[model samples]
Target: MRYFIIPALGLISLNTYANVIQYFTGISYANPAELFKIKQTELIIGGTGFHTVGKFEGSVLNFNTGQYGEGSAYTRTTSLLPYGRIAKRFNEKTVFAVDVTQPFHSNLNWDEQAFTRYAATQTYLTDIDISPRLSYSLSKQWYVGAGINLNFLQNNETNWALPINPTASANMVNRTTGFGTGYDLGIYHVFNQSNFLGLVYYSAIRQNTSGTSMLANRINPNLQFNFSLPATTVLSYVHLFNEKWLTNLQVFVSEWDVNQYVRFINTSAPPPLNPDFTFTMRFRKSAAFVAAIRHQYTQKTGLTLIGVIDHGPEKDEFRPLNFPSDTQYFLALAGDYRVNENTTIELLYGYGYEKTFMNNHVQVNGQNLPFTTGKVHLSANVVDLRLKIQA
Candidate 1:
C-alpha cells in the first residue's frame, strides 16, 4: 500500500495547460510483480482535490501605435479527481488488474475585466482512462505486464472574438467530446528482497471528434477535428535501506509534440472552404523527475516526503490566453496509517510553484497587439486521501 503514495504526489497542480505530466506519470495503480509477490486480492480507492488561486500581470500593446500598458489578471479554480483500482491474483505466476482514473483535467477562468479576456475568459478540458492489464512472471525475478486503455475526452472554450460586423463583438462558445484507444507495456525486475526497478510505456491515441459549432452557423452542419493525445514513458526505481527507511526515484518523458495540429473540418461549407484549418495553440514535448523518501515512525504509522520538477512544454510567441504554463517545482508530504489488519488509509498534501514567463505580443481575431512585455505567474496546492483493502 505504501506504493500508493507515489502517484498521489503528482496530484499537485500548477500551470500545466499543454500536457500535464501528473495525469500520466504513474505506472499501473498496483504493480503486477508486487501483487504476485503478495499473492493477495486488493482494492484501492482514492480522490484528490486541488484549489488554485493566482494572478497574471502583463501589458497589452495598443493596436494603432504598438504602445504597451500594464494590466493584471486574477483567477480561482478547483479540480477534483477520483480513481479506483482492483488487483486480482489468478495464481502464483499470473496477476491481473483494472484501473479507472483521470488522466487529464484543466480548468482556467480569468477575470473578465482583464485585457486577456478577448482571447480567453474561460476554458476547460477533461479526460478519463480505463486500463485493464495482465502480467506473467518470466522467472523468479522478472515480470512483464501488458494492457489496453480506453480514453474519453471533453473540451470547452468561451471567449470573445471578432464578429462579422465591425461595430460589435460576439461571445463565442465551443464544445467537443471524443474517444480514443491506446496500449500499455511494462517490465518489472527485482534485484533483491529490498531493491526493485520498473519501466512502463504508454502509446499515443488519436481522437476524431465532432461537436456543435454554434458560431459557425454560416459554415453549415458543424465542426469536426483530429487531436492526438501524447505518449508517455516512466522508469521507477525503489530501494529499501532497512526496516524503517525506503526511497523511490522516478523519471518520465512525455511526447506532447505528437499533438502537432488540430485541423478543423467543415464538410458542409462551400467548395472553396477547406476541411483543414489549424488551431492556435502549439504544444511541445517535456519531462519530469521525482524523488521520494519514506520513513516508518511506529508499528502502524509512516511518513513520506516527495520533491518534483517538471520541464514544461515549449512556449510560442503567440500565447494562448487560457493556456499559460511553464517549468514548475512541487513539494509534498504524506502520512500512512494502518487502521486494522485489512484496511489502511493515507493522507497527502502538496504545493506547486511555477516560474514566471513572458510574452512580447498577442494576436486576437487576426489583429496583432503588442505589449511592451507580459508575464504570468501561477501557484497551486492539493489535498488527497486514499484507502486500501487487502484480502
Candidate 2:
C-alpha cells in the first residue's frame, strides 16, 4: 500500500478566493530487461523470476481563508508498499506474466472555522491491484499483450467540533470499504536491438463504496460515493545509442469525463448539500521525457545520470479533493553493480519539483466559498533496491 500525508491547515484560513487541487497516484516505471542485464542468470529457466520492491512518498499543503472568518488546515501522510511479479515463456512465440502492486495509502486532516465549527480528520485505504497478463509474438519484431485487474478499497473519517458553547466539544466518525475489477491491453514493436515502441490501454474500473457516518448527537445514515476510475492510454518509445546513451519518451491520456457523480444515501430529503454539483471533469493528459547516459569504468560497475520532465493537463472542475493537480520536473542518478551471474543491486536517488494554480470556486451547502489562488511547491527524494534469483 502507498501512504500520503497532507498538511492542510494554514492555507485554509488564508485570505484567498480561489482553490484547486488534483492528484495522480500511479507514476512508477520498471524495466525487466535492465534488471536481467545487471543479473546474468543461466538456470535453464524459461520463465521470469520474482523479487520484492518498496516505495515512499510525502507532500504538504497550506492556505489562508481571511479575516474574522479565516480557518487554516494542514495534513501529512506516509505509506510502505510491498509487491512481487512472475513471468514465464509458454513457447518461443508466447509469454505470460502476473504482477501485484499497491500504490494507494493516505493520511489527511483539515481544520477550518469559516466553513464549519469542527476539525475534520480522514484516513483512506485505496484498493489493492492484482493483474495477470498474456503476450503473443506476432513476428520477430512485433508483440501484443492483454490483462485483467482487480481492486479493493477502504476508508474512515472523523470530525471534531463544539456544540452551542465553545467550551464543550463533540466528535463524529465514518468508515466504509468496497471492491471492483477492470482490464488492460498493450502492443509493442521492436527495431534493431536498441530501439522499441509500445502502446497500452486501460479500461475504466468502477467502485461502489458504502459506509456509515456518526455524529455526537445524531446518526448521519449510510453514504455511497460512486467512484469511476478513469481510462488511460499510453504511447512509449525507447532508444539506445551504443552502450552509453539511452532515451525514453511517453505520452499519457486519460478520459476523466467518465468520472461523473457522487451519490449520497440517507442524508436529508433533498440531500441538504450542494444541489448544483455537476460533473464537469473532461480530459486529463500529460507527456514525459527521460534521457540518461551510463559510464563504465570497470567490468562490474557503472554510473547512470537521468533527467525527466512532466507536462500536466488542463484544469478541470470535477477533479476530486483526494488528489492535487500539478505539473512537475525530476532529476535522478543511480549506480548498478553485477554480483556474479545470479545476483545484482541498483541504488537510485531523485528529486521532484511541482507547481499548481488555484482559480476555481466551490459550492457547499448552498454557499459559494472563495479560496486562495497561488502556487504550491513540492520536493521529493526516492530510493529502490531489488534482488533477483534464477532457478
Candidate 3:
C-alpha cells in the first residue's frame, strides 16, 4: 500500500499495488535440465499465452452505521507474456542455452467512480530477464546446470483521493531501467529408468528505483526507494511406469519473508512526513504444489493433465487490497504434436479459481480506512502454447 499523510490534510491511504504488491513473485519455470534430451540443437519460438482474467470487488463501510456495506465489482485483464529458449548440445556431456522471458508482470485498472478508487486506481509493472546457461552430465544418471540472469524492471501506478482534496487523484512514476544480475543453479538425477528427481534455486535481485509522486497541481520530486526481489527454490519428481504412462510432482517455494517492508525516501516533507518511512508489503513466504500425468496415445501425439494448488503469499487478516484471494486452484489440459522430425508443438489450456477473501480490512497511519477494506473475489482462465525445433 502507498498511503500517506498529506502536508495539509488528514491521513490518506492509497492502495497502490503497482509498486508495492507487484514485486518479483517467483520463477516462471524451473526445469533447467529440460534440454538434456535434445539431440544436437533446439530452437524454440512463439510464446502463446492465454491471458489471466481477474475479477475484483472492494467492500466499503458505512461510518454512520459503523458496519460494513456492500461492494462493487471490477475486472482485471492481461495478455500472455513473451518467452523463448535456444539450447545447443556441444557434446554428449555438455549443453549451452539462452532464454528470454517475463518472470514478473501485472497490469490492473479500477472504476474511477467506484468506492474503492481512493485506495487504488491503476497499476502496471513488468520485469524481463535474459539468461545464458550451461549444463553438464557428470555421468549417465547425474546432471548439473547453472545460468546467469540479466534483469530489467519497470513500474507505474495511480491512486485517488489525496488528503488535500478527497476528490483529487495522484499518480506515481519511477525510473528503474538499470540492469541487475542474478544466478540460478540446478541438479538432476535419474534412478534406474523409472524414477527421477530435479531441483533448482534462484537468487534474489536487488532493484533501486527513483522517481516522484504526481498530483493534479504539484509535483513531489526528490523521492527514492529500494526493494529486493525474493529468492525461490523448486523441487520436482518424475515417475515413469512404462513407455506409455508417466507422472510428475513438483513443489515451488518462495522466500518473500526476506523482504516484507518497503522504505520510502522523501527529502522535502516535514516532521511527520520525514525523510524515511516504511510500509508493510502484501507478501509472505509460501509454497505451491503441482501434479501432472501424461499419456502417450501414439508416436506422434500425446496428452497431459496437470493440477496446481497454490497457497497465495498474503495472510487473511493482514492481506491487502491487491491480493483478493488467499488460495488458488487450477486444472490444465495439454496436447503435444510432433509436426515432423524437426518440429514439435505443445498447447495447454487451464481454468483457475481463487478462494474469496471476506471481511478484509487495513489500517494506515493508525487510521482505520473502512472504505479501503472490503471483500475480494477472483477467478481466471489461462492458455499456453509453444514450439520446439530440433536438428
Candidate 4:
C-alpha cells in the first residue's frame, strides 16, 4: 500500500511526543491508542495521509547513600531518540500535524569522579523539539487541538579542584545552551465509540544563556543563567470495553511556584539563598494509571498488555544537578504482526521501578555537604520496534 504509507510516516516521524513528559513522568495511554486507529476513513489516503513514528530508550539510575560516597553509585544510560512527522487531512474537516523530536539529552556522563570535587565532574543535557498541530472536528463527538512549541537547550558543567595552597588552584567550567518558544493546547471528547476525554496545556519555556567561566576566568569571568520550563496541566481518560479492553487515567499539574531563582547575571553571587529555597519542594502534582489489553490471535496476530502507575516529583524538588524524582512502576508487553492486508509489525517490552529521596545540605561555599537522605532506587528496561505500511 504506498509502501505501507511510507514506513508509517517514517515511523510516526520519529515521534517523541515530549517523551510523554520528558522521560515518562507518566502519561501515554498509547497516545489515544494511536489517535484512534490512525483516524481511519479506510486509513484515508487522498483525504490526506502521512505518518511516522520511531523510538529508542535505555535507562538506569541507582544511588544509595548512608551519607554520600563510599556506599553506592550507579548511573548507566543510553539513548538514540528520533522523530519526524507530517500529517494532513483537510477535506473531511481539517487535520494537520507536524513533528520533530530529540526531546532532551545533555550528554549524561559519570564513570568516575566518585561524588564531589567541586560540584560537577561531568555534565551535559540536551533537547530539541518542534511541533505544529491543528485538529478540528466539532461534530461526531467533539475535538480541538492547537500547538506550537519550539525548544533547543544545552547545558554543560565541568569541575576539578586542588586548592590546599598553590595560589587557590582552580578549574571549573560551565556552559549553557539556548533557544525557546512555547504554547500548546489540546481538547478531545468522544462519548460514543467507547469513551474518551482529554485536556492538555503546556506553556512556560524560556532559555537565554551565555557561558564562559573557568571559575570566571580564574575567579570572576562573565556568566549568565536563565532556564525555566515549568507550567503544565494535563488531564486524560480513555475507556474501551468489547473490541479489546483498555483503560487509562492521567493527571499532572505544575507551576513549581514559578521555580524562583537561578539567576547569576554578571557573575559573583551566592550568599542570599533562601526564599524558603522555593518552599523546599516535595511534589507539585503528578498522577498516572494505565491498563491495556488487546488480543486478536487470529487473522494475522496481535497482543498488547500494559500496566503502570507513576507518581513522582517531590523531596524538596531535589536537584543533584538535574532530572531526578522517583516513584514509578511499570510492566508492558506489545506485539502485532500482519504480513498481509497491507503490512504491519511491531513489538515492545518494558519493565521499570523507582523510588528516591535524599537530603543533606550545608553550603555557602563552606562545604560540609553529604547530601542524600533516604531511599533511592531505580530500574528500567524497554525495547520497541515498528514497521507498518498501508497505501
**lDDT of each model, Cα atoms only?**
0.64, 0.45, 0.62, 0.47
TM-score of 3: 0.84
Q: Order the candidates by lDDT, highest first — what do you get?
A: 1, 3, 4, 2
lDDT of 3 by residue, 343-366 (tens): 988887777666555444444456
Question: Which residues of candidate 3, in runs, are more than 4 Å off?
Answer: 1-27, 58-70, 156-161, 170-178, 267-277, 358-371
Per-residue lDDT tens digits for candidate 2, residues 1-391, read: 1111211111110000001011111222222222222122222111111111111122212111121222333444343444555666666666666666553344444332322223233434544667776777778787777878776765633233323222333443445567888888888888879998887877777877667655455565565545565566767787887676666666655554564333434421122222111333333544445556667646777777767666544363332223334555667666778788655555565555554544333332334443233333344544444444443
What range of 10 consecutive residues in model 3 has the weakest lDDT sum?
A: 16-25
Q: Taking the tens digit of each residue's C-alpha lDDT, what string does model 1 give over 231-335? A: 888888999999999999988787877754456555332223233345544567878888999999999999999888887764646344465666777788889
lDDT at position 323, candidate 1: 57
Evaluated at residue 57, the lDDT of candidate 2 is 22
Model 1 CA lDDT for position 171: 35
Best by lDDT: 1
Evaluated at residue 119, the lDDT of candidate 4 is: 23
In the order shown, what is each candidate's alpha-carbon RMSD?
8.7, 8.9, 5.0, 19.4
Q: What is the lDDT of candidate 3?
A: 0.62
Q: Each candidate: how many clashes?
A: 1, 38, 3, 26
Candidate 4 ranges beyond 4 A from true positions: 1-136, 150-171, 175-179, 182-192, 195-208, 216-239, 242-245, 248-391
The sequence of per-residue lDDT tens digits that candidate 4 reaches over residues 275-361 is: 111113323554555556667766788787777665644443243423344456677777778888766766666666555554534
lDDT of 2: 0.45
